[model samples]
Target: MNSESAILFTQCLQNDFTSLLDKYDPLPNSLHIGYAEANRLLGEMVEDGPVFSLMDWAYEKDPKQLKLIHIRDWHDPKSKSQEDHLLQFGEHCLMDTKGAEFVFQSWIEENPNRAEIVNASGLNDFVDTNLESILKPYKGKSIRVGITGVWTEAKVTFLCYDLKTRYPEFEIAVCSALTASSSLSMHFIALDQLKQILGVNVFSSIGAFTEFLTGDQPNLKKRISTNARIASDKLNLDPKYPITDLDKQILLYLFRDCKEVECKTLDGGFSGNVVLKTKSIDHLGHLQVPCVVKIGNRDLIAKERTSFERIQEVLGNNAPSIVDFCELGDRGAIKYRYAAMLDGNVKTFQKLYGTMLDGSGLDRVIDTVFGEQLGRLFEAASTEKLNLLEYYDFQHKYAKSVRNRVETILGSPQNESTIEIFPGHIVQNPCLFYETDLLDLKEYNAISHNTSYVHGDLNGANIIIDAQDNVWMIDFFHTHRGHIIRDLLKLENDILYIFCKIETESEWNDAIVLTDFLHNQEDLGIPLSFDPPREITNEKLKKAYRVHRKTQIVLS
Candidate 1:
């Protein structure tokens, strides 16, 4: 075996230990906490478990990398010593019974098999056992001892502490996913406590075993990411998106034909999904096909796949196409073509056209985008739908309609708003323009007579400009059979709030005035005047007007 190797210690994976999953009172002397959480850990503990997967990965794939030691929670049945084991957790894991046997059928009953077996009782696992003599050979070699199994607060914790102290040099890695506790909270708390001890590494997912085995740098930097995801649905835990090792396993499966593949988080992240740019390299070290991968909430990414477009020349124009879609446990993953620019620069409209007139913003390129690309998008919206009233309710009719659609965090509209925005700055509420009585059934169809499959959130960040200055849209979670007018309005707002970035009251006033002027121009069905009208001349605001004019032509 290699000197730099590893060993895995799986504890309490026995019939008797199954009592921890009892729904009611559980075992009379069991450290059972709650059934639901226990069962969640159980789902991955036994049949096709992550731990078992690691065991197979090390042995079946490359036994030279690892060895296994199964620790059975066995207690002597004949002993009337009246110790704490009999008093607290009474008569559990009794010797010569099914309770004390290994749950996995492959584990040898006696010693000297592929995997070594150890029998320890209650809290006395570290006391006077053959465990020390068994460790005689692999003692000095720098090896990683992987810890897994039940009652994280008790046996797992105690065993890890003993290993850390006795074999201080050995890397003590505890697979958080493989272990359980009397209570779910204790399981997490124990992990945190164990981290304080030196030479101990608590891996949140067993997928991280690869990092330990190869001494690879940690992929998901924030160890508490999984916990944070579970703790809150809305917490922006990390500024950057993270992918687990299991996610990599799935990606490897997808890109198996490629010699090697690499992934990096893309620029846009407001969609609550990690957009990764994946590039493949062949044996020659030359770049091959590139794609975009998105990992996010299962429901969201899965829903995104429903409208996920594939490579097709719909109307003689191409868009980023979906490559594949899959579920990573509770998260969903989908990959698409990586749209690159002529100069090989992969930039969003936001990065490419800052304020649509700033340093990075090239009017010549943007003009081609406006004259050609965006027009193609709007033209594709030929499919008509007669649901203007439904849009009306969403737009202005409902009590919570306007605020719910406009005032939001990160431009993501929430369902409610308690505070008014930009009071006395410009127009107080946008709903002022969408008055209830002003909306008429006769005008509903007249206002928006056309429809198509529109991007629900057509922000500049989601719009990708490619090599030929063509547009490739991404982050289509909200894509639906909808109207082009909605997309036009959304694009208009993206330029207004996202790009303009109005700093002062005067800039805000200029933006408001310019917006009103653009609206009038859009209604007029003509090109905007050569200059900013209505005394609107904030250099930045004028550029906004120019971009708005191009949109006006598209709308016409």
Candidate 2:
């Protein structure tokens, strides 16, 4: 942290971070001030300054802390090797603290810190050879790369392009302090790489990208890579996918009781669901069992874990039992498990009904499986005693937000004409505008005489129907206590409004059946039901529905 170095850091930010500053508007002044403060502190510190470590003090402050740009891990000088390699990444970081520990043979294997700390260049042949075994665990996954010290431009280039090209399935997340003028050269490309890992194509170049990345849209960046699409596409647990030393060890731990375990990639999407079937020695003899493993974002897995505890508290034996749970590392991985894979999920049923919605079997299956389970869930949740009155107030606020979004759309000249034509089209073909009106209906007041804990995002996709017609809820990403309106509306709207907008035949028929169920939902056993006054169904509500529907189509 010398004066020359301090001046260099400030200059680099002024240049490379220009687009980010302009895009955020507020950052130009705040960041300059932050950097000035940071430069002042550099006089008393060395390589890693506490003042600079806060990240917000100097570089662009990311309010959500959405991106983990770099990481560092060092060995004590007194260790057996007596030599320090910069924070060695891959296996060392994954295993030294968590995952599983490695056992060494003899002094011949004394080289624990074998891989050199990668700098701003290519991986050496030794690193190329050893990195395979280390990264094998993350073959079709994302990982956090560690930089021993500060990250330079060349290092960023090698990481973003080279590492990405070499390991296409593996996404990279790193945390590091920016250093040297090197980063100034490729900051734009680095932004692309960052957004790519986040599974977004928002920035075609440095200019367009910074607009949103530095704006007041913290939630969007936080949610960028957390979607099911990325989760579904990346993981490849197929046995044919290849395994290395560490992969075998992981398998052994996962199937501790099993011998001759064979894993195969299932049709599960995102959220990393794979089936592991194996033979185990029991009291009688060898027996076969099937278990499902889920590896995904730590937050989502953490949510499911919490849901498991709540289910056990309220609906014991009604849900799948959790087999295991573990956090891989900071900005790395999270694993989840269920004792066995069930018959099928609601998504499977929806797909099936997509072609066979007219069939009585599909209708009966939905009623028998979903109806019964939902009844029990609501019954159990009813005992929780939530404040429904306050929940309605929150719903009104949400409705207002939706209205604001609609007004924004209406204010845009490009959308004004489209809004004008919609009402006329609605009158000519009410069926065509049926879903639109439903969306427009903002009368979300009134509480069902019954109140209970509502699954915050209960869509057909989240519900799983098993062989015994038992229902298991997955992806409890949004779970809260309130009126059951959220769950019921989400299910109905997803099946009818959302799916019907894109799908055809049985899918539409399925929507129709679901719509009928909603209109006649008296016996649905949901704790909360609502009735709204005419005044509540404002013009903004309708416009918002239209705008939201259009946005969904475009984004999807």
Candidate 3:
């Protein structure tokens, strides 16, 4: 060959043939040696020829060598495309006279009886016809079955029916790209029935069917068992129905037993429904019982609707020792067996202490009565102090955030000139505390001085010392931070009113001694002067007093 053609051939041998041989395993013995010799010969030929005359000389020597030239040109990356790769190679192989003759000779030597050696180089031009030729062999017996988009019940049913009607002989297998939404179990069930109807079988993958048709079941039972175990494990861990009925029932019972009870009904009597009456049996025993029964929907509302058994377990002898509680019916109605205290016989410290009265002796007496029990309750509550602090912080942050959100709703940049006010604005405004100056009142000052832990609402009804001198401090729900003098002020206020009406020297002396004792107590933080006009009136006083007593205790 000429130098140019020889150079091209030598390059092909170096780049393509070297890599091509590595790709194939157990290279043909004769062919491998022949190719290696051809490569060496081509390299020598290129060195001897003049580059200008090499192409013409090569074409004259062997026209069959044109394939090497064409392959070199076609492989250039810049000219390569699907069209160029197939059409160019195909058309050149079929039309090239010398190349076709060489291929025909090789074919004849291999199979002498074969008359037809079709040149499929024109296959690119007649894609449809070429496809027809390949499929023509199987056309009459080939099956045409429908495939489903989603493996739902309806889709699977339709696919089965269509398969049976259209391709009854060949077995049909539904194909699915297993997904969370696809039901493989349902698909398999439908396919199994279709298999029987068509007298064929079902399979998931091509390998499975090929093995099945060849009578080689690839341990499908093992696969099915493994898959079934995985599915069952997944279903077991699902939280859709995690809790049992008994669990829910117990939770509901506990919630009802723990929630605070509020009075919903009142008896038509002088004593209000929410009031409690205290009776003392000398210094030995004291009993405080609800004055009026509060019931709703046939259920009695007490501090809690705890069972008599639970009450006995907790309080032992302290829980209204003489009284008997009976369940009235199957539906939770209850009745208490006890006598109501006589109005005159029961002495509420409120009557003796007076409104805004100071009674240090009474404070000592009441503290003596419930001090130990209160201390225990406080200790028990302290265990959850971290939780309490977290809740307090959350509440404080929430209040500030909500206030900002409400302000945004009430006034925006667009409506700044025409802002409208609502009735709730006065009460809910964040600036109310700063503007009112109520916290600076002298009454608050006296209250703050007299008690660091004041009986926040030291009203008459809250205190009751029976004939036996056993003190009972009731209605502690409104307890708050203030001076012990405030409790004394409240007590003195009540005693003064009684004194003004009856002129009792004993009551006056009691009030004076109590007030002085509260003032002298260094730890009590009592104020020097009694701040009169304590903002609370007889009409609104009860509500105000209740609010003051329930002062939320915030610990820093």
Candidate number with greatest TM-score: 1
What is the Cα-based lDDT of residue 303 in candidate 1? Answer: 58
In Å, residue 320's CA in model 1 sits off its true spot by: 2.4
lDDT of 3 by residue, 146-256 (tens): 222222233334434543554444344432211001233443445555556544344333223322223222232232233221222221111332323332221222112
- Please provide TM-scores, in order, for all candidate models, with all chains considered together: 0.47, 0.38, 0.24
**Residue 340 lDDT, candidate 1, scale 0-100:** 50
Clash pairs for candidate 1: 33-182, 341-467, 342-467
| Ranking of all predicted structures according to TM-score, beginning with the best and ending with the worst | 1, 2, 3
Per-candidate Cα lDDT values, in order, are 0.60, 0.35, 0.30
> After best superposition, candidate 1 residue 363: deviation in angstroms?
4.7
Native-to-model Cα distance after best TM-score fit, residue 433 in candidate 2, in Å = 18
How well is each residue in 1-556 modelled by candidate 2, as lDDT tens digits? 1111010011112221212122234433221223322222221222222223223222343313222222122223344432333223312222133211111112113433322221111223113234344344445544323221122233334444545676675433322212221222233344345556543232211111122233221122222233212222222345554433333333443343343444553234444432232233322345544454544443455455444433343444444544433232211111233344443332344454344433334444445333544445565445334445454443333444554565565564222223442323311222223324445553446434544555677655565554455445555546555564456566546554654453444433343333343465464444322322233233322222332233222212
Error of 1 at 390 (Å): 2.5
Query: In model 2, which runs have C-alpha deviations exceeding 4 angstroms?
Result: 1-236, 239-253, 264-288, 330-347, 368-370, 380-418, 421-423, 426-449, 465-471, 501-556
Better of 1 and 3 by TM-score: 1
Q: What is the lDDT of candidate 3?
A: 0.30
Residue-by-residue lDDT tens digits, candidate 1, 1-556: 3443777778887666643354565553454435544454553224333444454454443345566777877677566653676677667777888667665645353334677678776575667467887777777767778888887888888888888778877878876656777655566678768888554686643445445655432222222232111222221222365555565554554454455665656653454567766666654566666777777765567556544431123323345655544444555566676445233446787777673453225555444444454455556666454666566344444545654566553265432313345665433444444454345433445353666656677777787765566567777777655665676678778777788788988887787777666655545455667667767768777777777656655456
